[model samples]
Target: MKTKVLGLCAASLLICAAPVATFAQPVAPTPPPHVRESIYVPVRDGTKLAVNIYRPAENGRAATGKRPVIFVFTPYRARYRETDGKVVEAALNDQLALASLIRAGYVVAVADIRGKGASFGHRRGFQDRTEARDGYDLVEWLARRPFSDGKVGMIGCSYLGGTTFHTASTAPPSLKAVFIGASDLDKYDFVRAGGITAQFNTRPDEPPSVDLASLPVDGDEEGTQLRAAVAEHAANTPMAPLWYGMPNRDSVSPLTGNAFWQEAGVYAYMDAIKRAGIATYFWGNLKDEPTGQTLFGATNLGSKFLAGPGSHCVPPQGFDFTGEVVRYFDHYLKGVDNGIDREPRATYWLEGSNGYVRSDQLPGVESRPLPWFLTGGKAGRQLGAAPGVAGTAAFTVDYKLPPAEYFGFWPQPMDKHGLSFTSRPVTAPMTLVGFPVAHLTVTSTSPDADLFVYLDQIDAKGKAEVISFGRLKLSHRKLAEAPYKNFGLPWHSGLTKDLLPLAPGEKAAVSMTLTPVSRIVPAGARLRFTIAGADPRQRNLKDIQITPPPRIGVLHGGRDPSRIELPLAR
Candidate 1:
């Protein structure tokens, strides 16, 4: 659906669940001569979105003009300030995709989004009209220039991929097409997986990447470097802005560049964008692992459910994107019948001991929802399909200190923070593709506790691998919302809303969301979950301090039990 909106004003959540793999395309085309190397373009908003136009060089080293414009916009500064984009130029100049597009009679426009690098303006996100406006303004402006063919198309993966969605939604007159790879359609799905916080671990296992507190102030040298990022003014706070649907005010401090500003998850606005009617070429990661890709420097729609094998910024395994993504633009914007629209709607890599298996749609296979029950006892067992009894799962631990795996992956079959009890292996294969709800009755020695859940699969070979895990602070149990601010934006809450603090023998239901997946847990393979206080990979956010060390106690009742609901594809 094509609709118009101001551009680059708002930002959204990210999708981090993806697979890993890499593959480049076959380089055959050479660019034409005469295409100017670097040409800056201005957007209507006073934000100059920097663009480098490349000519169709089938065999030449430099440019020759007059070709269709293929545009790639990014929030990350396109080039370094002083390096003269040398590093970016050297790396991307010969990139198979860009070079091929040039060779195919296309003038490529690689621009840095406003407020970053060469471009100047406030740093808004794709979820806003500013980005769309910036893109549309760039294309319309470029089309009239002597070098452009009056048509523009887009291509990129991860954050760049996300931009395609943003651009497509704002289908402008000059905007013809886009090639989206490994990205989530909604911001919430990308940012919050299955209704929980993200554990972005691929590249940085250290201090979370969006550390606003570490950002330089407005006058500091470091802040000067981010002058482009600083908005000319603040927008709304803790609320989405008016037209662009983003919160414009600085609910949080900007010294950290408003890390919480991107929380307007894209999922909530899909209906509006869908009504905009932007067609896209959606690509998933390697095996839909759990970490999705967004270009390293760009902002992504944080989602784990939609993630595949790709990394946060790039694909897990690179692709012959030159053929696929470029061809998409060539056909739609260039008026060439490249037969791209005739290809399968989706493509993916299968992880069954075999390589990738190309397919038509993303779900790839039929999957159904599975429900299990948790009896109130130490074991946190699963009650298959049987009607759930009014029961509960209970446990106790050393609440003085929490375990690490706060809410990501774990070592063994599951997180070992609390206690676990498993049922016999499934008699048949099973797969779950939805959130595993944790209806638990638990409490802590200190009036608060974080219930961690690690859902896993034990293969026929007798090895356990973690599929997904989650956690919640007890104080947040009765609250309708989360009370902390990462850059001042409130985090999503439903699990915490239901959390009930535990005293000895205290019981309550706190639902913990697990990762979604399409895998074959063979009959001999057992579906398991470990309800602990933490995993080794997580950083405890709740500053729970206990003066005198005491054990964390929680009890489970088999009749009215706590259970995890699994989605079955078989």
Candidate 2:
């Protein structure tokens, strides 16, 4: 297989540049001649949403038959002026994929959300209730259109994917199925996960301007309508202040005085979606933020999940699941007897093995927890099956540690900044297939400190590569029962009321679950659990910085044992 380096973008979904891989790419079906039309779709509030429709054509005219409509609701412009001065579809990144669906006899519609695109009206907040209601209106409208078969399905990635969940939550009658990729179900958890603020979430919104402005709909020769829409976007609410101001899930937004996070998240309306009984397919990358969210939806809402290896929205090199996507839509939208409903509920990619695993249920149910205790030895710190003699290892906080590139997926040299605990080489191959929980008994000179834990696989040659990582703000260490099914993993409420500040020089037990991973550890390879004070990738606006660097001590062996629990596949 050819090797490729993926570059991560700092968007909400963290889109990655496409990398050439050896996997067979999906070949598009020979497309039927299609007629493209641009028009305005008016919603409940009379706000005009810009929509582009691609319909199967015959003899240079739109076909006269009704077909299921596939809809894409996006904040990104439905169509935008490219640098080459040509207007093109901007919502769906892959035109070939869109064309394939169109070739399959589906009428594809792409719409600009309320503010960001060539649509009138300003955004209240990111994925707010109004936008969701607009989705309901749009879906119903598309179903009622002349050529529509009265069945509507949604498909998108990133923000567009989030819109699908938001729309599905409203339980629109005509909306039947949805395919979502790289979307966060819990907006609060994504923005301030583990009580650490994501820097990208707090960055200012930078809409397209100048040469890359939103394209005007057909018949707007002077670009009058597009210019007017851009004007209204000027009044759109700034997302940074709203995100930065809300420290807790229940915190009110400064702009709207509402619990924006709660209202914006699909988690709040999961029941509504379940009641709607929409067929759902979630595509997530194991190295991305949406894997856990995908598992949660699959377990709770009976959705099908495709978990693959890659950073952000990019799939592993050579791994293409577009054929499965077509199968899903055919089964649900067209009522085809494709037997997709009888297939495995979850499918995931294994890293070291470079293969896929299918399960009747979400991962972790058929796995056993393998605990490795952090123990101190004469040959430095080590991870063992049982607790060793009581001991403590000290490390000073390092604020200047360089951040890992590619959102921490790119490997960096270890032992340069943080304390490391290495496990003895394994005798046989072992497959770890789920979340890894870290339990640390620590004492810090400061009242609170951030703990960044990394799980690495080390070969006999002494080369180490990061597998997965997790972080927690010491003050947010208080665990709470999750509101939904969370696979029995550690849950931190991230609520202001649940915050617990540690006393100076006092021992505190912190437990956090690292991001999910699936990898096979070869025999003669060792596992290393490394803990650092800070990672420059994420920022905490409320982090307490002491005048002098604080010293953190990890207490282990007895009473307050520090260990990592790995989910070994059964």
Candidate 3:
């Protein structure tokens, strides 16, 4: 969590400092103060984006010469500070990393997207076309500025990381490179994994604030300027609040502007980015933990789940995060001839081994496919074996039951509300490095059912560790043939397509994708696959409300072999 400022001696080499914890008070060599200023940069539609520029300064004056600009566009009001020993709380002031970048002799510009902050415009949600174009305009403007060296790169985490993705999609000429870490690329996939609205998605939204006091303005001069800007904005025009999440499929409409429901509907515009071929440096966490504040950046291990070209690890451990950023920017923006790009395209952290595995391609392309068929037997014996006989497992959803009591963990009291299948203990190590898919035959008495599939690893002592899970609305189960995208993962055209409801007792094939994982199941470990009418764990969060069928059934064995596929790396 600590920021390590590295000096750029040569455009290509970084003089890195020892890694330090950001919030944990360490003796960090304070670099020269950076001169901070705010300006409004107008975009194509006459809308101005409020940008805060931080340039390296000495003796209260701008430093000599120009430097490549690291532009960060965020909607989450840039003012930020370390909250606990692990997290950062955001408000308005300036990007916490601005000083670090400036001290490193790089110009840093953090801008609020077109609709937020002191910027003038209707603030739309994430990845708005206008926001992306504003980035292109801001980059070109920064490149043309006297303090800029005509090379610009975008940097940040979470919201800013998302903006970087969209901006790259625009393929602006001045955007030379980008460094992104842990941002959700696909809005639909992230918001509605398994066709269920994520608890994080339902957060209440923050409205656009044009007031100068809304920003983290410091000192008399900056305060006076901010007041003047606020007055001018008011003299010319005016503004609104947004909801962060939707309860059901139909509740997503009212939040078209400045909200998650509308903003996250589209897929990540990676096609244009790939075509533009800008130097890209990206990484993500293998697992997304819904904790503390709402920072919507979770990488579905299945979506574009690659390793070496970039790297991903389980967060709060393993890597030196800030060091990685410095190394990447030094190579690309600083023109450092570091062998980063030449390194493996994918690197994954092995959970149990506490070591990293590198490969040229994720899933290795040549990796073996391990398929385990769903069989008819006892509830715990529902996985593996041949389809000798057909059987069905049923579960009921009771709306009267409180979310807490219904969805609480282990030796779960609600086991009667769902069905689980456990696999035999692995005699040796088993490594799965890619996406997992479930081919299920389902029948529900209700018109639709929200399906949640969980994968857990149980040790010899029977401690179950939830590894990954995926969901799909039975009605939104239809798949599209974007075969090239995400490879084997099932793609659902959510909200956009018709919701084909299921009839009473109608047996349908449900192709479900369990969230991708790259973990080692050690010896004597058992893999448990669980299916439920609703995911109680998420339901207990209060944000996620489940309105599933009274009862749902999973059919296994017989001619219609319901199976789950795992990608076993060599």
Candidate 4:
């Protein structure tokens, strides 16, 4: 199941966390009847990308028929070995996925992206233009191979999945389709969500070190050499001491650093893919691990790091990830005439429910804006019906303290540091399918302050589950004109040119749209809108040294009524 969230992230952030889904069990299979070969495929720049091909074999010999190709591009070494000098098997190297396609009479080619594996080049990061071009070259090369038909299809998850879309953007003639499971579509926003860095970005999963001399020459020689080079690079460029390391981390391409917002630069070319009109499949989860991230999106990229329910480290048992890919490839590459393309471009998992909802657009439901007013008190407030009478509430925040000290789920924890508004218990089930928005009238004592809001569902038992979160550095409150808008969503470019400082002590209107969420607020459950000066609990929370003035005030129920609007599905 897939879900969606708002876009963009902070300048200095680190990202981490991967989620796993439960897979359905499959019958035991015989040894793979395929011929495996390790070869180097050259790109336009003369750099060779290490590739391992699996071609169907009949009776221990290569099959004679030409077949559609399934190409997978990955930075995570298409082939590698363990420290004990044992050659990693397909199951360990994602070869099991290829076996499924091979059995179905298709050829699978897994390539080590340039600079990562035996492929020669410098690593640029995810969706680099060079990588995209490399994909184009690889696809064309595969199409012309003796064992391949003219059609080529791509499939992968995460980095591999990113390459699928990047390659498709070039509109490779031989590239007929792309299937992305979970990938970083909105690269920049995901790394630094809402101008705050994601916590995962800080701790990256570095590859295991390999001994160049001890490597087995009989194994993938190029892969062995590549691992050795990577190890050497790591040794020479050891990470800086914890606090002095690069503030911003890039998962795909780690150049020294990039202009903060340009992380999603790869997406600038998505229009080409859309115009190419290739059959595309996107699989995302509404609830995945490492909170606030999303798995996939067709065009306007969806949320990047969402906190879903699954563990990314373990693959779900029983479910066949390959079966679904084969179905997609069969229809697009082999012309099997399946109704795959006729289906909606997206399939999202509805949170709080077991089944999925398909739609040509996100959210998949019609919704109306429901506004809740913030009324009463300097210490706390109730999220009741829009007040017919006006009221004002003031809360003080000590910005000098660590955000962790201020982090709290319930209203009481925020009693001295922040303020909140709560709704009455729901009498019926309500599903929120789009971005939740909050419009506030505020005055700050300092030039700037950050607003962190959490939209949570408190059950009849009082246990709280954070559904979605939103943040805005007060200076970045200015909204940009978006190319596309859904559910009256507000857009921010996060560009330096658009940033405006808050006028001290003057009332200013600020409107923020929290991340998109899809959940059924069960009966007898209450909806809570909690606000704080800082969010210490955010997965990517960083102590950016941003200390708002001693106090921040929120004015409500007058000409400028402070209220939050929830998008409830009708």
Candidate 5:
């Protein structure tokens, strides 16, 4: 009673200090310094989901009683294997909410999603929605347990945040709120953009420090054991060619028939969620999000974060959901009063020319267009297609090769063979909010072909920051096979289709989705789109048949018209 009263008084004090409700204004941006860790929490399923408990460890003493729980589900290793899950030898480092909530008298849990870390299960991304079920089960178990106050909230990055979407739609009774950063629900922008796969690109190598799920158990013959496992899984499944659940490499990819694709698509669940009246604040990386983020249009360049100089997007500060998460649970569970109702209700971060910008609606606001044309080549500043007529550029590289180094699922850099055409400084700053569509009428001598388009920001000092990029196979353009079947509506998934290949000098309207960005290319800086066969973040194989563009291209057709869309500040 006393804590609730004190919290209410504090909120009242804050309200009195402000002249009026500033819904458009940003949230309080600072946090106090106090954090602690708990070593364990076994879910109802007997799965000992490793949890790093965080709270005030001031003077090595913890508050005597149960605190509200903020649980984060991540695929990353929760703790080292040898610890019996009792000691958190280390914490999941990227998320900031974990640290901040502990200071606010809440118990923060970093739960390793099932199938990853020490948690036992065959690991694959969103596999059969097992993690989502784990989340619901954990909530009910925690609410009834003594260590918890029977209230739960969630937070995390990429896959961690992605899990929140699946679980959120289910509305676990114990789950009252969540802060999802860099995640998406649906195949909105995963693969088959414009109805084709632009793969065979190299993925960026994983940083040595970032944890990978398939680490081998210590043994005299580690390499052989690991290789055998990889081989077994690889052979058990040949899902990739079909883009379904394959083994090893693609168990987590969308192609996996696992629960991820089995469950109703994210789009299938939105109307249900709105009907349920659940309020969740969804967000995504301003930069790179491999799987779900862009699929639902949650984070695009314009309304999301745009690339910029000196902005090292390390340890994304975006997942830093603080005191607000606590208030959400309090309002729903303890009946404490917090101003969540009066705020924007939902928020997303935008890298405006001036720091971070906040908004109530993301897609509707930033999805508008800012069309620019590609002009000039190998020479001065030229971007997009020429005003009325379309334009083209051509470069050739080996098709049998991989673009860059590969690790886990992400590919390293094979960017050298890519071609870049840049625009001189914009008189002011420019922000791209949606996918920039490239209508390249192409041709190649090869019977089949592949292409990739990269949109980047060239800074004042000649450094390049990638905004958004996409890839596709020329054959899957119409999304068919020997046995043709037209799936549901094409535009709903929001994938830019890849079709119309090159045959010697033959041309076709080849579309590309410049991964959405919203960074301000500073004055005197440039915007460049590079066309190549691969990128560093995805696995790539050289599949290009070089015959170059016809020197001019134009807006072929589509609801978005043939052009790049920019999310400008209102």
Candidate 6:
């Protein structure tokens, strides 16, 4: 009887295992999305702009449906050739973001601006007027395509983002919305911030390489068309002479006889963009180069913004904004009833705080002016609430001082290249969340000088992290009434007519507004403000080599009380 019972138990176990094995069979994986490459869309000038269309896939083929289009216009190549010879889309490295929108049944299109990639024509200048007209034509052309539903939205970061603004300013009937990231609204402010030309901005465009050549469009299998297009780029205007030669906002370029800054900037086309009524969403990083433009777009263009603490065109780690992009497009393009429209206009990541903050407008709360006077004493240079005894601090400009890594998330030691003023340890946590203005009373031995101011937060362990910085050329120190709302910050017109060179040994009051920032300083942390004459990062082409490095003196206390005013959260 025991043997019979054991045999029955074994039979029951086998019966149960049969169903489990059947259920564990391998499942098929989802197919990759589909893309139609090398299509040329003609603009008004009969120039064919090369574009790659990505469509939602069904059973490994493009789905049959009329879908709203997400367009990207970029000077950067629309497609790139990898080392392995595989062709891929290069919409400002926003493939993941585009992939999400494509999966949600939207057709995505990326086009090379007039002269770049496989497109036919020559680039006149950076974001020239012709490019803006081309964008208008492309939007209308895309709307008429068989796969499109007569509605379109623009999206990109950096140069690509700038194109979106330019295109939207044309007010294409089909263009419904735009999502911009890390793009400059003011051209002069970016290329020549504070009247000092940014060296990196004047560098020549990257020459094509074997491992990184532009990918040929679909029918150009022999790459004949691509080569001809590249040859046309030989006539492209060199950036160095175009940017460095200007020196001022109203300066005309001898090459084109055009006021490049006045025509190229989105700020110049603000009225047109406002008339277009294109829904705008600007993604900005506090640590990026265009922080000021980000704030300007938010406050002036009726744009919703998401400002993070990442560098350049990057978003904060582990923070995916793909959903937010889709949600925004969904509401405007598809007329979805998602609550994104009802959400706050601004969302920002406040560093050293509880993480992200949401509010109807940027900053979320009122800010009070908190002034810190520069003082020098036995304890070294200090930043105090009250003015110290009258005195002047002198330092010779170090032209040969090696350029430090200008911007990053890491901490760097404060070098002796500049004068540093440190504040006492904070007794209570303080949140600084706006632009900072540095009012400096200075005298220079030379006729003119450059001033660079840096603000850093030093922790208990003595690690100093730069928070915000600004620079100005002394000759461009004349102030002017801002054409638009300037958030109450001082505005330097940076025009040739506004030049004010300093006389030797004559004191001049200079006030410069640093880039916007949002950081929380905990108790025991100290703040440091450094003033220097030269930053190799922003070298002017004409002034690269000065005959003699000038000595600069900062007159503090007494009548000329040099101070830095910060916007502290109330």
Please provide, for model 6 over 78-117, each residue's C-alpha lDDT reduced to its tens digit, 9 standing for 90 to 100. Answer: 7877778665565323332676787778888889888777
What TM-scores do the predictions have?
0.65, 0.91, 0.77, 0.78, 0.66, 0.91
lDDT (Cα, tens digit) per residue for candidate 3, span 224-274: 544444444432212112323443333453546233444443244555665
Off by over 4 Å in 2: 1-21, 24-32, 90-96, 207-212, 315-320, 403-415, 539-546
Candidate 4 vs. truth: CA RMSD?
8.0
Best prediction by lDDT: 2
List per-candidate RMSD values in Å: 10.5, 6.2, 8.1, 8.0, 9.9, 11.9
Name the weakest run of 10 consecutive residues (lDDT summed) in model 5: 1-10
Residue-level lDDT of model 4, residues 1-570, one tens digit each, is 222222221111111112325554334345468887877667898876677788888999989988999888876666665666556534223323566777888888888776665565655444667778999999999999999988899877656767887888798989888876555555544544444543333444355443232222236545555564455334322221221232222322234354423434445566787677677766544433222223235445432121222333222232335566677789888888777656554444445544344445555236577888877755447787765357656666545334542223222233334777788898877767666789887777777777777777888998877676676767767776643323346655666567667776777678887766666677899988777776554433344544444366777776668888887765
lDDT tens readout by residue for model 1, 359-396: 23333133344556544324335545453445434455
Winner by lDDT between candidate 3 and candidate 1:
3
- Stretches off by above 4 angstroms in model 5 are 1-66, 81-94, 191-265, 271-276, 290-340, 345-352, 363-368, 376-381, 384-392, 398-416, 431-434, 478-506, 540-570
Worst 10 residues of 1 by lDDT: 7-16
lDDT by residue for model 5 (234-317), tens = 222222343322211113444444433325245445554455444465444444534224334233211222121112122334
Please give the distance, in angstroms, between residue 25's alpha carbon in candidate 5 and its true position after superposition.
24
TM-score of 3: 0.77
| lDDT minimum window of 10 residues, candidate 6 | 13-22
Which is the better candidate, 5 or 6, if ranked by TM-score?
6
Q: Which ranges of candidate 1 are over 4 A from the true structure? A: 1-36, 58-66, 80-86, 90-96, 122-132, 181-263, 267-272, 286-310, 313-321, 353-361, 375-414, 421-452, 460-463, 470-507, 510-513, 534-560
> What lDDT does candidate 4 reach at residue 500?
68
